[model samples]
Target chain A: MTLVLFVQHLANGLITGGLYALVAIGLSLIYGVLRIINFAHGEIFAVGAYVGFFLWRVLGVPLPLAFVGAMVGTAAMGVAAERLVFRPLRFADPLNSMISAIGLSFLLQNLILQVGGAEPRRLDPFMSGVLLVGPIALPLQYLFILGLAGVLIAAIEVYLRRAWNGLALRASSQDLGTAALMGVSIDRLARVTFAAASALAAAAGVLVGSVFLLQPTMGVSMAAKCFVVVILGGVGNLPGAIVGGLVLGVAESLAVAYVSTALRDVVAFVVLIVALLFRPQGLLRGA
Target chain B: MLALDRVTAVYTGRAVLHEVSLRVAPGEIVAMIGANGSGKSTTLKVITGGLRPVGGQVLLDGEPLEALAPEAVVGRGIALVPEGRRVFPRLTVVENLRIGAYSRADRNRYREDAARVFELFPVLAQRARQEAGTLSGGEQQMLAIGRALMARPRWLLLDEPSLGLAPKVIDVVWDAIQKINADGLAVLLVEQKAFAALQLAARAYVLENGRIVAEGPSATLAADPRVKQAYLSF
Candidate 1:
């Protein structure tokens, strides 16, 4: 491939990886504290897209408001899922909770399919036009995705480090029984985690829906890739999820560019296998 | 003041503590000494709300702590420096200290509590930025106590504070515990080192096979023939 084409593919990979990071970080956060793999996380992402679509198209809300609406709406769904589905299963085995998540995922997808139909739906671009930096032509939408993801991730990092509740959340993740002794309410922390993770996933969903298209099955592939990113990064590590997402994104982009499109979906699994073999602890050691 | 009134705790349908009763009056340092699997730790768990009693009640200042969660128990001014010095391993010392104040409503008092902790363990102050996992075992134990102190607790529960420490370090820990008790905070300590616990506590209880076999003033217990024969061997 030409140098310009390679750079273009690199940019595409980074942007796509940003989306993956957003999704995977949420998954990792829930898993870290709650110790349950949220199989329904991808469905939450899809729900965000539909929420954003309806808010923008049907309600004629502004783009930013619609984005917020999607996030808030999906966050409510997340809180509901935790209270209604996961809360009762809190003390059960991890496998039982994970199976419940899978069941919830299927239920969500079927619900979406019945309401929105099987056809893929598209949203109007949140931005338009392109900017050229040297020989590379960069789309504005990609820039928006990169900018938004950067802001949200930075905010989360800040909250985890500096805020009191965030510190409690981090502490709870490290040692639950001790954290409780320290006066960190595990129930409230779990609810906050679900809401935050769901919001991030919703943001990714809206961004991806605008750039590409949304369908009931979109979450399946997205969830698969996110799980790969989480495990490759480290199961419960936050920074690991971001790095894992970018690496997978860039690798997949390079695979599509230098090899064939058929190699795109296979790249993450290959990396996952390689990571499990050599660094089962994770690419990052701990949270 | 904290009291366990005939608290009987079970694990997997088997009783671990059989109607254990204990109390820590204000400004008192009380110790519970026992052998392995003797349910001393289980007794601490019952007080901290880590485990529910199958029978009887835990009371704080004569108020029932029956329905309170662990954090709520902390809010009522009870903090547990749990066994194993379970600090947030990845967090900085200061961060871990701050988390101890997680349920506190007064931000200024939290700051003051942090200052008091730093004063109590100056070593923690010097290495405030270091990850807790990097601290020496003794330092980790100090951090664990310091973290509990940050909650501004009226009563403290310490489990095996001297579990793995050098003699000099254990002295430092004992001194800190005594100093904190001098500040009017009641303490309930559980220790495997029965002799040291008896030396430090004003009163002590001997637990064997999940029952309190002996309870009296520490000095009297230490001088008792059976207590000396069973626990004070060189």
Candidate 2:
């Protein structure tokens, strides 16, 4: 392939990676503070897409308002999942929580299938077309995804650094017992973290609906890819998730460019295996 | 005042603290001394709401403390500088201190409290922007205490403040403990260093196999033959 083609693929992959980071960051945050790999996280993404679809397509709400609605809706759903499902298992084994999350994922997927039907839904973009930059033409929605993802991720970093609740969240992730002793309410933090992370997943869902065919099972591949990103980044490490997502995205994009679209999805798995075998601690060590 | 009456903490169905009882009055320094796995830490856990007691009660000024959640316990005015100086490893020192004030109602007083912490340990001020993990053991210890102080707790519970420190570092910590106690913050110190613990504390409890085996004034415990044989042998 030409250098121009390679750069084009690289840019596209990075855009895809931005979306993946949105999903994986939530996964990482939940694990960072809650220490549970939320199996149902992908479902939250799908739910976000559906919420956005209903608001924008059906409810006639504006696209931006639909995005907000999706985030709010999914955030509430996440808190409900936490309260009804995970919170009850707080004292239970970590294995039990994982199992519960897996169970919850299936339940949510099927529930969405029942509610929304099996047809693949589509979301027409509010604005479309591409920006021609020299030799490479970049889609506006893709740029939107990358820019928004960057903003959201950076916002999280700033919050964790500067905000009181955000600071407490980080502290809680480090040491739950001590965080509680210092007056960081475990219950409240769990709810808030779950909500914030779920909202990111929802936002990604809205973006996904803009470009991809949305179905009940969309979260399966998305969540799996995100897990790959999480594993690649290192579990519970924020920076790792971001880098891992980007790396996986670029790898997939390049594989599709050189090999075939058949190998596109498999790239994340390949990266996951390599990461686990070589540097299971992750590409980045600490947060 | 904080009181534990026949509190028993079970870990995986085995009692770590079997009917452990203790008391710390206002503005007093109380020490609980024990060997490893002797339930000194468990006793603190009971007080801090980390581990719920299977039996008995923990009272804070006659209010039931054990019934409350861990964070609720903090709101009720107790803070723990947990063992291992569990300052968030990746967070900056200022962030750690600010997080310590997570339970404090007066957000405006955070700056004032942080200033006081910096006054107590000027090292923390210099390292305010530094991640907590980078701090030396003594500095981390100071940060842990400072973090606890940010809560402006009625009672400060310290677990092994000198766990892994040089003699000089321990001296600095010991001085701070005295200074805080002098400043009228009640302290419940759990330490393996029985000698120094007794010296700093006004009243002390000797824990053995999850039970309070001995209790007396610091001087009396220091002089007790059995206490000396068991704990103060060093």
Interface RMSD of each: 0.8, 1.0
Q: Output the number of the lDDT-best candidate.
A: 1
* Model 2 lDDT tens row, B106-201: 864688899999999998999999999999999999999999998888899999999999999999999999999999999999999999999999
- The local distance difference test score of each candidate is 0.91, 0.90
Second chain alone, TM-score for each candidate: 0.97, 0.98
Estimated TM-score for each candidate:
0.97, 0.94
Write model 1 residue lDDT over B1-234, tens digit each, in one string. 688889888998899999888889989999999888999988888777778898998988899996778778889988889889999998999898889888788843676788889899999989989999999999999999998888888999999999989999999999999999999999999999999999899999999988999999999999999888888875
Docking class of 2: high
Model 1 agreement with the true structure over A65-151: per-residue lDDT tens digits: 999999999999999999989999999888889999999999999998998789999887879999899889999989989889989
lDDT tens string, model 2, A1-287?
39889889999899889999999999999999999989999999999999999999888999989999999999999999999999999988999999999999999999989988999998887468898888888888788888988999999889877788888888888888777777778789999899999999999999989888899999999999999999899888888899999999999999999999999889999888988899988999743
Error of 2 at A39 (Å): 2.2
Task: Report clash pairs, candidate 1.
Answer: none
Q: Which 10 successive residues of model 1 chain B have the least lDDT summed?
A: B103-112
